[model samples]
Target: MTENGVPILQLSGVSKSFGAVQALTKVDFEACAGEVMALVGDNGAGKSTLIKGIAGIYRFDEGEVLFDGQPVHIHSPRDAAQLGIEIVYQDLALADNLDVVANMFLGREVLQRPFRLDEAAMEESALKTLDSLSVTTVRSVRQAVAELSGGQRQAIAVAKAVMWNSRLVILDEPTAALGVAQTRQVLDLVRRLADKGLAVVIISHNLHDIFEVADRITVLRLGQRVNLYKTAETNQQEVVHAITAGKLEHVPGMASL
Candidate 1:
């Protein structure tokens, strides 16, 4: 937690190395409920590796991860999900053969007794969740995922995560494949997620979306955190500088030019 009473999700001095390649080094970052924190860095800057660590795919060799003041070992993706950590990848991960409801409850089927799928109960719950989210454009949860627009598909992904009672939803380049309108829709969904008190960690290269939805920005450069600041405290230029030059700010301590 911060000095204030607000709770926080934190990673302290986290490091990961593959063979001789050091992908991440002593990374410290935090995310709070009701806030969207954007993670920005160039390709191969270790952003993916760090996030994968948090996602429970790669166990870090150093540092600790805490959720709401408790250190937790997320050894697998299932562990992450059970802890309310959900990831919405850039690919969206919707099976084209499956309908909306089936996709939403893919591995986690609502079942009775001997693992029999409870179709009626699942459908009712899925519809209720969608309706509450104002997703009216969907004809039916029975429609194939391949038949939905990019925005609709993205909506299904977010709804599924939210329905799973996720406290932290990590979106990886959510709007990358979306057009202007679709991007707008997805950004709106992200805002709604945070507004509903979910800690959102967005990994995106698009500054516009970052500025639109993020309350805090953490810039990573060359496998290290350069700076973390509130959105109102910095601009695109400074973020670019920190990300490229590996400097958080243009300090005045430099020798006379």
Candidate 2:
């Protein structure tokens, strides 16, 4: 547990390469249960590469991944899922024509004893999951995705990730495109995810949203982890400096890279 309790996910000296390009260089990261870790960086800062490695889309060439304080290998999305990690990409990847219930159980649908698609069970489970997340924006679980607002769709995407008992949920730019009210609703859901004792990682460029929902902030620059900070100990300026310059003057008791 490294003294701070066992982290749900931890990456140590993690590096990934694509042919001749070094996408990540000795990156160290950790996320704990019930805490929101915000990953912030500029364009081409290797944020996406880091997330891909964790998602099992791109294997890290060097380093180790520890889940619940035990070393594990993740080579595919299924492997990550089996470890109780779920990621919601920025695009959301929901089928517009499908209803909220159908989208929630798209690939992992439940079946009854007779091998028939269990519509009642799936709908009930979907509604229950949404309720657990305190997602009440959408009027009904049977509402079509195409008919729901952007915030509602984002909520459903998050709900789907959490529905499978996922311990760690990573959201990529969840509130990038939405009105003020919609953004607020999505941020509220993000906080509720942590409140339910699930580890949450958010990749976003919005400092405002990060300040609003994150408990800790991890900054990446030039394919490397610059610094990690407690949200309360650092302000927007310090975070911005870490993102642009990769370092800042050491705070009183905070770790220095």
Clashing pairs in 1: none
Clashes of each: 0, 0
Worst 10 residues of 1 by lDDT: 248-257
Per-residue lDDT for 1-257 in model 2, tens only? Answer: 12343489999988776666666778899989989999999987789999888989889988999999999999999999999999999999999999999999999889887678999999998888988888888998888999999999999999999999999999999999888999999999999998888999999999999999998999988778889988888999998998998752223122223
lDDT of 1: 0.85
Stretches of candidate 1 exceeding 4 Å from the true structure: 1-5, 113-115, 248-257
Question: By TM-score, who's the top model here?
Answer: 2
Q: Which ten-residue region of model 2 has the weakest summed lDDT?
A: 248-257
Give lDDT tens digits, candidate 1, residues 1-257.
Answer: 12232445799988787876777777898888888889999888788998899899999988889998899998999999999999998899989999999999999998977868998989999998898777777898999999999999999998998898889999999999989988988898898888778898999999888988899889887677888878887898888887788753222122212
lDDT (Cα atoms) of all candidates against the true structure: 0.85, 0.89
